[model samples]
Target: MRVLVVDDERGLTGALRRGLTAEGFAVDVAHDGDTGLDLATDRDYDAIVLDVMLPRRNGYDVVTALRAAGVTTPVLMLSAKDGEHDVADGLDVGADDYLTKPFSFVVLVARIRALLRRPPQVRPAVLAAGDLVLDPAARTVTRAGVPVDLTTRELALLEYLMRHADRVVGKVELRDHVWDGPGEDGNVVEVYVGYLRRKLGRDAVVTVRGAGYRVAG
Candidate 1:
């Protein structure tokens, strides 16, 4: 899963990025509300950690803008204020969840997991192609009811392919989604595809002549 942490506090955001990555989640950090809002609006993140106080744009404004733009990606609002009005306002402005400052990382992760439990309106929980099954919650892949252990990058690549099953996913698409934010080696996609084909088997995923890859459904 991918998460965006939007906070001006470099220390807090950095800690979140490290901690969430360690927990098997791809993370992106935004130091300000504008950058954060842009990422949240443009990308398909599993969840967002947005601080209520921000420069140029507050959390409420950011959430309102996202909702107005029809970005229903779940958001967890963070604030130092525990006042009843603040909490209510955050919820009223479209935050899916709220966390007061001095919060425990454990609790924050728990809230994120809970929000993720609710099905995404755009992305489904389980993605499958032919006999292959991927459970996002379990982070497990199975073929013909047999388990397949995948490396972190492999799992991420497979998940991306599954999401666009049967479509010709170009190298650019793969790079943007599977790898971080592009600008890496173009051959990285091909290399990772080769790795996935070796482990998941060639028949499980196919390559087009000029296009990129597809998982035959």
Candidate 2:
């Protein structure tokens, strides 16, 4: 996969370029957000590792512009800010993933791999199923025109399901996309589906007996 590393830190960029190249990726480096934005706009990249603070345009603005321009390539943002709101803001701006500074390079590779695994397609900014609406960029969900609050895990699960609402997703598929937990137990899928059902009404998510779960699109 081809990846872009956009950060002002030269040493970090160099290290990432070498490390990611060693891991079998064609890595490109951009020291500021303007150069990053230009390269991102012109080239095709499988994933991007963007830093929050940059010289020209900030990472948030770059990602926002990319999404506005209909760029659906997955982006993994890098930042020193580890606060909850900061993370939420990154995702709200269309980042596919976020990692705090001084993070493990191993984890970074894992995250990039995860991003590459995602299906590349243009999806609506807001996903809808019946009266339920999910704004991925805003990280908000509403049911029947009313705001519905959900825990982070619940929201992630629902987002994945809603994104694939056209079909019945299996237990293993849900676990792979939703849970970052230790085990791949299919039971976790059932528990979270139950949680979603409770919050979104019993019939909100349909159970496919011996298959999996399906949500209306």
Candidate 3:
């Protein structure tokens, strides 16, 4: 799953990014609320970890703006304050859940999983294409009920492609989302696509010539 963590505390954000990535999540971090809001608006994220005290915009304003703009992505608001009003205000402004600072990593993970499983618009816990099954939370992939081993980058690439199954996703698009930043060469996408095709089968991912690639639906 993809997650956006918005916090100005560099240490906290860095730790969360590392921890969440290790947990098999594709994570993106934003130091301030404006950047967070922009990222949330432009991209589709499974969940967001938003800090209440942010630069330029506060967590409440950010969530309110997102809701006003019709972004229903689940948000887990974070704050150092543990007061009743603080938690209630966060929920009242459309936060799906709230967490206090100095929180346990295990608890945070649990809360995120609970949010992902919430009713009405819950996303599938496992993503599938043809006979291939990918468990995002477990970071496991199986084909025809047999396990398939993949590197971190390979798993990330496959997850992004599978999320947009059957769509012609451009290399630039893949580079932007799957990769960490613009410093990565465009050829990396092709290299990883080749790797996925080999593991999943040549017919698994289709090349659109100069366009891009598409995973069979």
Which is the leading candidate under lDDT? 3
Full candidate order by lDDT, most accurate first:
3, 1, 2
Please report, as a residue range, the 10-residue window in candidate 1 with the lowest summed lDDT: 116-125
Better by TM-score, candidate 3 or 2: 3
- Report residue 136 deviation for candidate 3 (angstroms): 1.2
Model 1, span 98-201: residue lDDT tens: 99999999899888867766745455668889899988667799998899988877887888788778478888777765555566787987888888878878
TM-score of 1: 0.83
Give the Å error, residue 6, model 3.
1.6
lDDT of 2 by residue, 1-217 (tens): 4578999999999999888766645567899999999989987676899999999799999999999988888999999999999999999999999999999998998887667556565556678999999875566889999988887667777877787898998877676546523365658889988998899889888999888998855
Candidate 2: where is the Cα deviation over 4 Å?
121-217
Clashing pairs in 2: none
Writing each residue's lDDT as its tens digit, candidate 3 over 1-217 gives 6789999999999999998877656689999999999999999787899999999999999999999999999999999999999999999999999999889998998898778767435567788988888886687998889898998888878877887785898888787667654677769988998998888888878999989998876
Ranking by TM-score: 3, 1, 2
Tell me the alpha-carbon RMSD of every candidate.
2.7, 12.0, 2.7
**Candidate number with the higher TM-score (1 or 2):** 1
TM-score of 3: 0.83
After superposition, which runs of candidate 3 have C-alpha atoms over 4 Å from their true positions? Answer: 21-27, 42-46, 106-122
Q: Say which prediction, candidate 1 or candidate 3, comes out ahead on lDDT.
A: 3
